[model samples]
Target: MSPKSLCFTVLVAVFSVLASRVVINPTPQVLKYVVDFGLTISSSPSIVAMFIPFDFDDLRRHHKNPDKGKPVSVCEDFPPNFPPPETNTTLTLCVDRNGCCNFTTVQAAVDAVPNLSIKRTVIWINSGIYYEKVIVPKTKPNITFQGQGYTSTAIAWNDTALSANGTFFSGSVQVFSTNFIAKNISFMNVAPIPHPGDVGAQAVAIRIAGDQAAFWGCGFFGAQDTLHDDRGRHYFKDCYIQGSIDFIFGNGKSLYEGCQLLSMANPVAPGSKSINGAVTAHGRASADENSGFAFVNCSVGGTGRIWLGRAWRPFSRVVFALTSMTDIIAPEGWNDFNDPTRDQSIFYGEYNCTGAGANMSGRAAYVQRLNDTQASVFLNTSYIDGDQWLLSYDT
Candidate 1:
């Protein structure tokens, strides 16, 4: 071969080797900035593109590696909100406005009980309007309140945001005790109906503060703040929940099976907002998190019109599975709670939901339709698992 051709061939071989090294070893800058920020690197011309930058510290704080070998318990950690359980005692406080058990007040009966214990106790409330604010704390569990009738045995209070210091979301009938149950009762908050432009008032009717609490055939009536399924895991079966605004809003993971959600007109919105206001604002804070509210086989329709729900928090996750919705449900199905930015992170979904409102044609792109396997995770009852606990309640 000629000397010039040989020299050119050697130069081409060196260039190929250099190119191979560059492709194999990414630059230090790329490693430090691009890979650490979850960027993808392409090799045609060596390009780095960031899809989603994940913050490892934030992830570590939010999620920990699961201890797979840890034994699961029937009852997890208890909150400080429940009252001590009552045992071996049956206390009947019949507060009839004018009849037998003539105590006119419900608070008097609650006060009459001595320190609660870890035993079974029943407080039979008669048919009357007991105007009082009642609270059952974490120390008091296993307390059953049986009412004479769903509508006749009424506990009415009208505590509004103006009456207290907290916001509408804070109005709650918190139940923290375990194994607490209420049957055939009505919890109503008769707060003054909001005037034509008042937007910032809340009157909470019932708040379940206890854990392992169940309500059967109960009625929760109010314009807003109707049933504060505030915290813990609650089971409400065959119950009626009525509200106007974001009535059912909280962080508790509750299951409402075979219940009725009634909607009243928003006094402020008038003609613009329709009647049945938002149904729920579940306060879950993470995507892979377990805290949320689920409505199974429930019917969502009321006398008035309203949106099905809106995001109460940025990462709020709620699911309506196999439920029947009415025409009153808005086409959008879910709202961003008046803020458009929250739509990016919220997980509002429906599986096998049927009704005029369940149509997904108008749903936002962020709303998801979970597949069968993903949906099964929500049914598991070891906390989020589908244990036999949900079956224990008699709806």
Candidate 2:
């Protein structure tokens, strides 16, 4: 069968079975330095037929009720247990660059929140470009960043890793507090994208190390290391994240629902067919760490051919379920970060993803052919344990 035939069609139901066991690709070659402008694929002699898994009953039930106490809306949510008796439990601080609001910058509003307060402090940012780096310290939890709109309200900076002394400090906005939320905001790193061999080219748009954080209708713009989802259980709904190499990296156990992953890397240079860049470089360093990335009902589209994900560290785990991928995905599907040894340890899988690039014929050997029992683990809010804290979500 052709590589296209091996892929799941857009109409294919995940609950159905993939009945055939066949080696669709005769040869699999890693395309890095080779000129591959045409994105030509050569088949290889590999034994492959994989299982497609899905909990049909559970999926239907979950969709019937997506809001499970997770803070699903930006304008309609308050911290849990903020009884109506205490009017001070909910606070709204306005930030306007024009000085019409309570604060002139995003940071000032964040500073106004009392440290370690149980109340939810909402910082409403007016529509404008706020050129500054803002950090919500770990001490200040339960804060919400509410903006007029993602495109109209932006917090931007132009600090490269070299300029910031390291990638850890280069984010336009860094949040270290728990239960943080962002709505209709854009966090941007405006530094010029760097080419290969360029020193410290990484520019981070946002870094979220806080647990139980949620982002709704947010946009993250940058080149490399765009989202430092460094370590946490985070939810990103209807968000747009654009970047180049290792853009969406970090060890966060995140669920990217209905988000768009855009690539900005110049994959082909001139006549060179060489492909560069990857959508995600999940940095799960150990098997014991309950950290992984799950993209559900997301779309991957943009310039340049890149891997859906690459193993940035040993035991890196990432899965894309029911996502629509374009031809931008490289044939190899994934990379072991150029280290063959790491391949055995990484957990990479795709469950019922559809697109021209969704064919598994030329995927890496380590790609998991998940069964329903296995796929269920990463296909829904349960992957991030949203039942515990999140009040609700869209299916």
**Could you tally the backbone clashes for each prediction?**
36, 17
Alpha-carbon runs more than 4 Å astray in model 2: 1-86, 267-273, 393-395
Taking all chains together, each candidate's TM-score versus the true structure is: 0.68, 0.77
Per-model lDDT: 0.61, 0.75
List ranges where model 1 is wrong by over 4 Å.
1-104, 114-116, 168-174, 195-200, 266-276, 287-289, 303-305, 379-395
Across 68-141, the per-residue lDDT of candidate 2 in tens digits comes to 74433322222343222324677777886545547888998898889999888878786656767899999999
What TM-score, to 2 decimals, does candidate 2 have? 0.77
Error of 2 at 313 (Å): 0.7
Give the per-residue lDDT of model 1 (tens digit) for 304-335. 55666778888887888888887777667788
State candidate 1's TM-score: 0.68
Instruction: Give the C-alpha lDDT of model 1.
Output: 0.61
